[model samples]
Target: MSSVPIADHALLSDCRTAALVTLDGSVDWLCLPRFDAPSQFARLLDDEAGHWSIRPVERARASRRYLDDTMVLETSFRLSGAVVTLTDALATGGEDLGHGIGANSPHLLVRRLECSGGEAEVEIVFEPRPEYGLVRPVLSAVDGGIEVLGGADRMVLTSPVPMRVEEGTASVRLRLVPGRVLLFALHHSAAGRPPARVWPQGELAHRLERTAAAWRSWSELHQAYEGPWQDAVRQSGRVLQALTFQPSGAIVAAPTTSLPEGVGGERNWDYRFTWVRDASLTMDALWIAACPDEAAEFFSFLATAAGPPGEDLRLQIMFGVDGERDLTERVLPHLSGWRASSPVRVGNGAWDQHQIDVYGELLTAAHRLADYLTEIDEGTRGFLVACADAAAFHWREPDQGIWEVRGEPRHFLHSKVMCWAALDRAIDLADLLRARGRVPEWTRERDEIHREVLERGWNPEVGAFTQHYGSADLDAAALTMPITGFLPADDPRMLSTIDAVERRLTDGHGLVYRYLAPDGLPGREGAFLTCTFWLAHALALAGRTGRARAVFERALAQLNDVGLLAEEIIPSTGEHLGNFPQAFSHIGLVNAAWAISQAELPAGG
Candidate 1:
């Protein structure tokens, strides 16, 4: 199995697809053409799967960072008397057009090596394992680069120097002195599409420069958050932007799939698809950290992709990046999972799960985007109205909770609270949606939801709001009630819930767990990074600024050297345990920081 620590990987995106690179300069996880495509390099999952690595022949310590405000990655490898800097990026369209970043990408990954001090020797291994290493491509030395032809993808690897190509692997070693520079790139094309060609060295260098410029321009135009943890907030914004599928405006929950929640465990999942549950929360984060430039466009994609609201009043919980609705789960048994976490999965089965909170998520998002929205057409307005109506009807039903438990469904309190929020937001936007006539119907169910939650959802003996209506389990998701305005943060019940969570649901370091209750899953998972941020956000809303900052810092300190966060953290060991560079974790960081900033503002100043 691959031994590289998950935190050792850094992200590079062209806004269409994503690649994960280790500090040692290996592209271990990449799916060509799109985020959800079959992997061209899959070493992140298995040792025998494909990987392209460029590292020093001798031992060297590597230090890396994202270049300035861009997704370009620069790694410096240092030995006793030599040092070299490697710069990597997936080439964008070279400009930020009026629509989105990375539009019209060239489908290229560019790498540049510069010997800055003394002399150094490096080894490059070019391996293409198409279809997740299930097929070995035919490799031949072409004019300027090696041709990799076979399987579902065809690609060309630009080579500036001669190399030995054999058995589908290319090997070469080069010695360089100070001031010497080498440029290399991989250009990708779908099978039976255009015949892919190698890039000239000069043009490859130019495209890299252009891609960096485009990212910087997008940052300048969009990000304007000035607050506590400014650097972390801005970096999270850039991560969110990179996670977006620019062409369709849908954002994946994370870039990589099958990264385990606990090593040697079975909690692995595929997260490369967009989730309706993330809609409103992701939008809220974009507004706080990065400007929501694609708010209207994102909503449009959701509306079109989801088709009509279901007549049965339930919608799909997730969709593929291309708006494909069928996310059937299957396992690749041939490939051993990362750290031996078995049965790597490609699609998410949760796509069809009944998640009642999605309605609230989308409606709340629409209400928040009122200023940025375009003219709401009849169909779009009706779809949203149906979402509100469905939520009002379904709040009382027992369904899968936000955690998507595999066992029998329960009346999750968080779901009920979100249903309440959906009606509240829909009523607020009645005039904008031109549906003032539906207000009374929405109000009726909305109030009933409010009263029911207050009555059955809270248990006096538990001293906190329970996970389900009658259970004593306290969940980290309860933190959202205050954050979503379902209740005032300082209200007695809300304060009691917060206190119980802090005292019971947290590890020694103050990291929050989703819940202590048995989740149908076999083993336990790590403390959710997003839940920790939720605690901080709730504390901020409650005017507990000191503890808020402390909890925020507790999560912030988990960022790897590159300032990217994972889905969860192993509390005692302090290692990242779940999917790397998770969008929800970053979204939580942005919104929590914004809340703290707002709380810190002088009382009338």
Candidate 2:
């Protein structure tokens, strides 16, 4: 286990939830039904705690990949004289399925295995740890399978394989021949309800086929990119699709839990929750990729989450997939974090922080939605008006900025830019409304924010905009100045700012650090991957394609052997830190790829 790096894990999901399938053939981290709900198998973060894994009986070389533009994963293993394929998916609106299983249905996990050639022995393991592995569920043999009960959650396993049950888990071993297929599914139902297994084996195959077709059709809808890095862009789009929480359109930052930024360094935090900052950017990425409905879905989620008008909308930096707000931070001391990183924590405390950037994300997202809507709905427009009004009233005050550093509040420059974005987007909304005979109040607020940012945030003495007002330090986040259209990428001020950031904060690996300061936390972290892509985009937009491609290549090399990248990469050891396979990191990759691809085009076209 120690030899296998966390980056070796591949993601599988059906939009509502996700699972981490390790290269060694284990489904370690899965939160069934919803992204934030209790894990059905949580062992990825804890070695001995919660897990439901299945693999071959013997150790073997393994590889995994998505089934062509779809969220389904096919992990193949090669052992002596035999090979097997494991296909896994969240059992929801599959083949012939339009959307997903209705939210009301019990959570289901469908594992299908087929032997293509030779013969092989297989093994299956099931371990259910309730409440983050604090409770030991009582397991019993049922009519056709096994039942696990703990607290309010119940799990029923339906399979033809025989297994022994003991302690808090179960395991089974079987021999397989070519053309043999096995289906192992776990159905989660209300307490006392015998697990429901509605789909027969034949129906399961049809569901798989339909699900594959659905994803392929969706991918076809993407207009031809014809860009140089189209592969990277397409991969990023698929990742974004996997990260989206379909029922509400909320996009999670990452799918895994407790893949630490710094091993045993107390930098571990759960990232399986929706973030306005990430979601806003994801929407932008989707729009660029021609995913109109996905972009609109993000705006709808923002509208729903931000609440009606100003009601002091909860300063939620994160929320559950189902829109639950009570993400109280807690630590599980029993099981060590990834690679013995101690004190694994669940639920992000940042949710309680008074980060002001969310308002900007909300407004900017709404602005994009309104601009694209053929006919804007009154409810959504009214919600946007209320949010813009509230933002106009509180644009100047300082609190936690985008990084959510748990330190004293200050005027974070990125936060201010986002505030400016809010007003700017609102003004765009106002212009659209004026043409349509709607309200005209958004113009004043929009101009006010623009003027405020230009006046209060720029520091001429530094020859570049500072990280915040009253500070002279260069911030890597300032790279967004060009991307947001706040300033031309080639403007001397923005160029100087970029040069200053490269001089001060570049980790010497082509990746950018969030800042040079400690950020009120112990131990140093790696260069942020997302910021690196931002720098790449800024470079290309500024007519530095060679430099941009160089930096982009350096960043791309940081992806693990399996083509999966973590949130950050250590400048010294090149070790990946932070959450594994982060959506933010992928989103940045797509943006950088597209920018690099476009930069190669002739200027006239």
Candidate 3:
């Protein structure tokens, strides 16, 4: 099993794909061409899976940071009497493009090493494993670097220094003096396609400069948040943008997959796909922290991906980056899971689950972006209306909740509330567009659903809203009630529910469990980072500013050194246990930080 802590890795992206570089200078996890593509380096999952590393020959201390408001990562390593800095990024459109990085731009991974002080000896290892380590490619020396040939894929690596290929791996050792720099570029393409041209050492400097500038330019336009927790908020926004598939404007849930939620357990899952709920929340977070253009593009992608509304009105829960619907889950038994968390999964099985709450999320996103939208084509508007109608029809149905529990479907209170929100936002949108006549039925259904939730979803005996209708289980997801505007934050019922959640769901360290109920999964997972952020947001909305700030800070404390968060955190040990750099968790941070900042602002100031 791979022993590298998830937090030790930093992310690099060109807005189309992502690569995770560890502090020790190893590219352990990367999917080429697209976020969900088969990885070339799977060392994060197993030691022998595959990896490419450029690290000092001797033990060295290292520290890393992003290059000022960008996804470009800089890691500085210091040896006994030497120091070097490694800059890593996936290449993007340069200054001459007259714009920021485009998703369809070339696929190139660039690494530049510069000796900042004294001199150091570094070793470079390049091992390419295609199709998740099942295919060992053939390596050959060509021109300035090496060419990797494997099933249906070709990767060419160009290096500034000489390298030797041995047993399908490339190895090199180089001495770097002060002010000296070495450049390496890897270009990927399909086997039958023309080989990608390798970048020369002279042109690499310009490419690196352009990539950094492109990221900075994009950050300048998208990041508008100037509130408290400014640094964390902005970093989270950048991480979200990095995870976005620029071509489709679809943001994935997370880049890595099958990172266990619980060590040595079976709860591991693949999170690289774009879930409707997650993508919708991403839109909401982007609107607040970044801009509305991303939200609009994502909605358009969803409309095209979801196709025309069917009679049933149910949408697929998630889709591939290219909008393909066949996300059938499968296991790779050859690879031992992370920390022995077995049965490493690839595709997600949740695609077919009937998640009724997605309607609410999609409609709410549409409503939020309505004002900023350039033009809502009649077809898209009609599609949004149908989604609201579907929620009205399905509110009475039992279905899988947001957690996507593998257990039997139940009438989860959160799902019911979101169903109500669907109608609410749909009604609001109709009025905004002066199409109120089209959604009169939505208004009536919205009221009825709201009343039904109050009557059946709340458990007065427990002094809190139950996890499901007629059950007394407390759920962190219920904390979204106020955040979604389904109820006033300070309402007596809402307040009681908050208190009950703190009393029951919290791990006593400000971390929150999704719920304690049996989830049909074999192992217990950690506290969900996003849910913890929700608790903070809910508190701020309730006017408990002091307590809200405390909870918010506690949640912020869980972020890794580089200000990135995973899907879950071990409350006792603070170990990041799920997919790293989770979009949902970061969205939670941005939204929660926004709420806290707004609440702290002097009234009308």
Summed over model 1, clashes come to 0
Please list the residue runs of candidate 2 whose C-alpha ends up more than 4 Å from where it truly belongs after superposition. Answer: 1-4, 95-106, 191-194, 222-224, 294-297, 311-316, 369-371, 431-463, 560-563
**Which candidate, 2 or 3, would have the higher lDDT against the true structure?**
3
Q: For residues 1-605, what per-residue lDDT tens digits would candidate 1 score against the true structure? A: 98789999999999999999998999999888999999999999998889889988889999999999899999999988889889999999856543467788888999999886688899999998999889889999989889998886889999898889889899899997899789989999975667678888888888988888888888888889887899999999889888888888888998888899888888889999998877557886888787887887787788788788643478778999878998999999998999999879989888888889888888888887877775756777777888888898788888898999887889999999999999999999998778799899999999999999999999999999999988999999999999889999999999999999999998787999999899878888899999999999999999999999999999999999999999999999888977778999999999899899999999994
> Please, what's the RMSD in Å of model 1?
1.3
Q: What is the lDDT of residue 410 in candidate 1?
A: 92
> lDDT values of the candidates?
0.88, 0.74, 0.87
Clashing pairs in 1: none
Q: Could you estimate the TM-score for every candidate?
A: 0.98, 0.91, 0.98
Rank order (by lDDT, best first):
1, 3, 2
lDDT of 2 by residue, 1-605 (tens): 22246777777767777877787778788776677777777777776657777788878788888787776778888988888899887754643232332233236677888776699888888888876667789888766567887877867787766678998677888899999887777777764655555345776676666667666666777534657666666767777776878888788898866777776678888898998778877777766554656555555566666566562444466777767778888887776777787567788988888777776777665565555664655655666666556566666778788888898888888887776676677666675434333234445655666677678778898777877788877778889888777789998878888887777788566679978766888877778998888888999999999999988988887876445678988788788788767888887888788888788788686
Root-mean-square deviation per candidate: 1.3, 2.9, 1.4
